[model samples]
Target: MTGGLPLSGVRILDASHVLAGPFATYQLCLMGADAVRVERIGGDDFVRHHGGSAELRTQGMGGSFAAQNAGKACILLDLKAPGGRDVFLKLAAACDVVMENYRPGVMDRLGVGYADVKAMKPDIVYCSLTGYGPQGPFADAPAYDHIVQGVSGLMSMTGTKDSGPQRMGLPITDYIAGLTAALAVAGALHQKRATGEGQHLVVPMLASVLAFMGSYAIDAQTLGRERGLQGNAPFSGSPFAGRFDTVDGHLVVTANTAAQAVRMVRALGLADLEPLAAGTAPDALSEADRARVAEALDRTFRTRTALEWEEALGAAAVPAGKVRGLGEILAHPQTAAMGCLDDLPLPGLEDPVKLPGLGFTSDAWTRRPLSEPEAPGQSTRDVLAGLGLSRREIDDLARAGAVAGPGLPPRSA
Candidate 1:
């Protein structure tokens, strides 16, 4: 394990918004990168105004925005304004990385695209995250998580036979794209360190989602069949590997191996059913045998509570868990032990807000001190100053409607 955060001293100029782009930069910030996001002069990130909590939304710290944007600064710049692009270019020159998620040509139209930034900072690692690849037929099409989910065939395969083409409960594609972009940026940064040469990373959400569903895609192509929604059933096709009803709740058991299937049956006190699995290969049971085993297990599981079955199956080396709600899981002892939530102190809120911490733990990685998500343009003055702009120049820019921030005079109506 390393002794400190790996990306310390790295600087990211983030012009991304919504989930994917912000999330990618947020991941890097969690690893100790100094990230400064540039919002439009009068506009905020879409997530900044929408989320579960109305109060937070009104405060410009919506729950969705707070989820991944902690520890980052914000500056507001109207790139269409006369000096706005100049200001962005200056910031880009000082940044080690520039990340944006605008559509294919929006950044170029604004005169702050990858080419423009690369011209200023030859070794800058630039990442352009979009819905589609930069040179595709659909490159100009706008997309959100749900759009990508539909386009990538994820929605088509998600639900049961009765509820066809259902969307996932969460914005899974956005998260996948974010993770992919973060990984690409990390790799590019590694290469830059090694060779002092930067690279442009074009991460498309559609491609990211497709890669995430590689297994299913390959299966569909190889078997020439679509495995329509099996609904809670493990893709491995084990009859014993799925959600089953219990007296009090539900339990999910994944007995994916031959030994595990046998052990699960035995643990459930279904000795009569043991023969069905004793010599059979996992996922290779005959249709009749599969139905029989599944029926027996389902009937037996109903005799006890989900937790009771979880304990018994777990002790028998079966992979099992009781279905839990978000609140229950968050409050679980295991979650507490993981220390994956950080308390952030926002200015207006009476109590500190709890946000997620680094998703993984390592002995070598040190946790950066928790910082609150910035309100739009919260750090405009300081960030501009860091770019070597004088107070007079910043004030002039604000007056000219090119920039806006707290304590600065509002842009002329």
Candidate 2:
């Protein structure tokens, strides 16, 4: 629905770092916004410790940061210094939106909170993303992705039934929070467009994560039923289910209705399951009968390799997919078919880096090519120049170690 690249002129100050904030800003960048990222001195983000590599240890550009920060310009600023705070407020007053992913009270302590910025620029959109919330009992609790997952009840639905309350393998809580923040900003911008008013947006990562868990929670709430992990299946208690092991890999065979189920059974070449389909209504089939049918479907699905099952499913118009790892998807033909893989140059690495493709398209072109993720604080001096800081003032900030961007690198020389 948002294919239009609607937010083209919008400029976003990506003060938020790590996954949640970066992911949201990335979305905005994809939608044709100028998203500038500001980082601390030395370019240190928490994910710098991802592996035991010398290059990564020094430069702090890990895969996690790269994934979130691609297609955005980056700068550096020392927010601790009084001069830094002054320059940051100046920049905040200049931008349409200011976004941050710090814990509650951090920005306020720095005197750059929404209230403080609102005084300087009345219509500025200020967004703060936190783990718990702006105000709550757990607001003071420090958190990471795993903690948010557990607190939001997402861990309850993550793994097998036996695994009880396990954290998700990926940083889903952080990611979803970013998406929520971006959505909130867009809504606020829309309102701003109409009223010429600015707003403060507080997005709690835990609450956003909880919204994801609510889909499962609603199903877990049937009169006396609590949803259990069937490993991987629909939360709707349907037999049109998931993750069947095949010869080469796994596949999820999901046919939510009897007709789709019939197609799925036929694709698996199970004539026996067809008769069971007749006894069960497409929508009204009891879970037990559906389970029995699903069991039969699983048996037949295993008869072929994942590739064969993919072909079989495609031929039958049934919803099916081979379970693929990240590498598998990148190398697979379907990823190219969907235009979700790209060959991009990365000078920092030995070879040109291959990465996931973009989401938006223009009037004629279906995809926009973007530069590789640069090191954090890469454009510290250049951005300040654009902010209209005089070369002399810029030189002073560089000397004071307060501001970064534009000709500052050469100051040490």
Candidate 3:
């Protein structure tokens, strides 16, 4: 699986948990990095016990955890316990990257912060994912995806003005931070390869979201104007570019350009509205003109089903798509052809678990075959053994409460 992959031979110690941290390491894992998840003894990651699947959640392999945790080894280590810190240092010395998402100074308090790990492995790519940066007024402030979305001003622009601020349906900020961290780590690794030097990377969810809304943020700051909530309307302000209802369902259209707007109206059999849409600029129409054009589009779109309109508008080279549910899109043939999902056999499950794969394909690199998401500490003994600990040593550590996992001796009362 590692052959010809970009991250082959790369080793990462993932001490991070939950969405953002775990997702970053997962991306690297898909690229062929060998990732080892270091979980606390008797304390599982939050996602391991919570997700959409009740059965899987009870088994401590919830859907959220399973989605991003495949292709990694799991090891339990009570870093506070005796001999635990020593074991962590040993693994650090052998790994190329160390990832964590604890609040600022939490790792320092635990004696495994960047400085500590860097002492063990001088040229290690250490990344810290947090809500804010390492040092800031909000550095210690708690944050979740929704909170960051609001704080980053993303919520301000979502939904309709009448509906007020709205959070996105998914944890978009967390995923953005995860992606940013992954890219930063990849870049740091490249620099390390060239200069034999390593560096610390700090990825903040709030900053990631702000960066994602870069143009909007800059416009708001420079022009003192806010797009606010315009519902499904695009920033282009084209009357033809927005969500419209069809006979059976709804679809979104993005006919921002004059030509595309003309094509869209013509495709919908509204040639009379073409003059209103053929303006040189998106906002060229007056409010009255815009209202007239929109009303016409609204009424014309209702003549066909959303899918029918999608096909018709698409054939005319106008950007449009039927609004679809997650399940519907996942089952669509277009999605299947993209190879963006994989089914892996989980150990205790009767059927293979369907999880998302890489977002894109490339001719230069192929992802590794995904492994099943493991139970907490599922590979503890094996990982310790790989660190050169003997079977007796592993059992001693388990019994001493330094580690816990399957295949380890039960800790004495």
Q: What is the lDDT of residue 105 in candidate 3?
A: 92
Per-residue lDDT, model 3, residue 141, is 97
Regions more than 4 Å wrong, model 2? 1-5, 48-58, 220-225, 278-295, 341-344, 349-352, 357-367, 404-413
Which sections of candidate 1 miss by over 4 Å?
278-283
List, residue by residue over 1-413, the lDDT tens digit for candidate 2.
33546777788888887688888887777666787888887655776445324665466656666665776778778888548888788788878888998889999998889988888889998989888887879988888888887777676666786776677678888878888988998899899989999999989998887676665666567636655444586644456666788978888766666777778767667777776654434456666777787777677766789978887887889877888787877777766767665555443566555666455334543444667766656776677778887888777887777766544643243
Candidate 1 lDDT by residue in tens digits, 254-340: 887778988988998888877776534544677888889888988899999998888888888899999999888887898878988
Worst 10 contiguous positions by lDDT, candidate 3? 274-283
List the candidates ranked by lDDT, beginning with the highest.
Answer: 3, 1, 2
Instruction: Identify the leading candidate in terms of lDDT.
Output: 3
Off by over 4 Å in 3: 1-3, 280-282, 347-350
Give lDDT: candidate 2, residue 292.
Answer: 80
Clashing residue pairs in candidate 2 (N, C-alpha, C atoms within 3 angstroms): 380-404, 380-405, 380-406, 381-405, 381-406, 382-405, 382-406
Q: Return the number of clashes found in candidate 2.
A: 7
- Candidate 3, residues 1-413, lDDT tens digits: the string is 32488888999999998899999999998888899999988675689877756777888787788888887899899999888888898898899999999899999998999999999899999999999997779989988898998898888889886889999999999999999999999999999999999999999888888787888877889989988876787778778888899999999999988899888888888888878877636558888888888888888888889999899899999999999998888889998889887787665778885577789877786656777788888899999899899999999998888888988887778
